[model samples]
Target: MRNNYHGFTLIECLISLFFISLFFLMLSGVFSQSQQIFQRVESREELEWQIFLIQFDKITEKGTFRDMSSTALIFEREELHEGKVVTLAIKYSSNKKYVYLSNNGGTEPILTQVQAITFDRQGDAILFTVRFLNGVEKVGKWTIP
Candidate 1:
């Protein structure tokens, strides 16, 4: 009498399972790396936003308001240079994508990666909203002194 077995050997089954587990391990690693990268980017964006707010506060607190528009604010600030008082005209404007600060006829970007910015006035305070390209919105109010 003879018998035939149509099944995988123990070694073959173990090898196949090892390969499947290795594939899953690699897949999990990819997901983990992507998640970490996303978190880093989000944190960096938040940090940039906080720094921008600080700068805005500093400029608005000590400067006299010259003009305010929907996307721009101009201020006249006095600084002492060489024992002489110099009046500086500073303009903060947003051009739909980023914020710029202009002084002495030169313009530089103060913040980047933004979608839009709006400025509104409420009594003695200025209300502003910033929208980032990544769908984050920040609202800030500063009182002119």
Candidate 2:
């Protein structure tokens, strides 16, 4: 009788390789998608930070103004030692409302958003907020003075 050996045939090796390659390809695709999502999130975060800084600077430097019926008035100043306050208010599009930043004396809308605006108060105390795209809000408050 001839000796019989059991082993994987050439077809088996090829099939195994094909499955392995396919798995690796799918994994690479998932990795690429994850990277893209991370980048997008980072970009959004950066944008939010930039917007906050700009709005803060404007409120701190220029003071605060309120506009009603196309009229503008300044109501607060940083030198009051009363501290500077900035509030971001968001309005819906259907209401034709705009976002406004209000300080001790005045309120002026820095920009309009369809969803939300984050508020950050600084000078004596600093406060921050995260306005999510989905209209969710998160607030952070700190004392600087």
Candidate 3:
């Protein structure tokens, strides 16, 4: 007696390979999308940190603002900084208040809760406040006299 054995034909093997390739191609798309999302998150965090540092440095420096008054004043001007106009205003309400930094035509408030500062017509003795997106507030005072 003779026995006949049969294995997968060439066509069957080729079909299996094609299916596997298709599956992997689909999976690769998903993996690439996830990687892009992670990169975007990292970029956002870096940008936030850099902006916080710039704001901190500007506030700590004494020459950033010249004087404090009931009206707003332009403290520093940078054409290359995010295309936003930067200014410092001294707002005297019922009590003495200071606005250290502002932006976007002085419509955006960067710093608040300013307690006291010395301001003269000569633009001497600057005091201001710094606030970060994390809600951290820092008070900086400088005396020119």
Candidate 4:
């Protein structure tokens, strides 16, 4: 008499499950790492764009008034307060690897990781070159009417 059975034994079943679980674990880890990297890149880009917008807005707000030096840019804003004309200064300081804003006497940092900054007065336009910590350089020009 002869008996024949075609089936996986208990040990064979356990080994197959173990290998499949290990493969899924490694795959999940790779996927999670990739997601983290992508998020980091996206956030950095968003922050940089926000900084760029703020810089441009503050500089170009009134169209035609500024005092600029090698390391600083100042904008004078005048508004009627309590029936009296009040003048305010918005100063941008390119110091300590940051772009700082100061009003009255309070100061705040608007941008960081700056490598260098240059302000050039070209006729009626102000051209600026900003160098970032990652060795990236950006040039922007604004006309002061």
lDDT of each: 0.77, 0.52, 0.51, 0.70
Candidate 1: where are CA atoms >4 Å away? 1-7, 82-96
Model 2 clash pairs are: 65-107, 66-107, 75-105, 76-105
The lDDT ranking, best first, is 1, 4, 2, 3
Candidate 2 TM-score, C-alpha based = 0.45
Instruction: Assess candidate 1 and give its lDDT.
Output: 0.77
> Residue by residue across 10-113, what tens digits does model 3's lDDT show?
99999999999999999999999999997886566456445644764655453354444534434554446576545544333324333334444453433334
Instruction: Tell me the lDDT of model 2 at 10.
Output: 96
Query: Highest TM-score: which candidate?
Result: 1
All candidates: CA RMSD in angstroms?
A: 3.7, 9.5, 12.5, 6.6
Residue range 1-145, candidate 2, lDDT tens digits: 8969689989999999999999999999999999999788767756765685577565545544332121122234455464655443222222433455544445555434324433344555445554555454545443432
lDDT of candidate 4 over 39-125, digit per residue (tens): 886578458757775766764574336588866667765554644333333334545777666655676776667788787889988
**Candidate 3 vs candidate 4: which has greater TM-score?**
4
Q: What is the per-residue lDDT of model 1 for residues 13-111, given as tens digits with 9 covering 90 to 100? A: 999999999999999999999999989988998898888888877766657787888888888766645543333333344454678777656776777
Question: By lDDT, is 1 or 3 better?
Answer: 1
Sorted by TM-score (best first), the order is 1, 4, 2, 3
Q: Looking at model 4, report the run of 10 residues with the lowest lDDT sum.
A: 82-91
User: Cα lDDT of model 2 overall?
Assistant: 0.52
Of models 1 and 3, which has the larger TM-score? Answer: 1
Q: Which is the better candidate, 1 or 2, if ranked by lDDT? A: 1
- Candidate 3 displacement at residue 62 in angstroms: 8.5
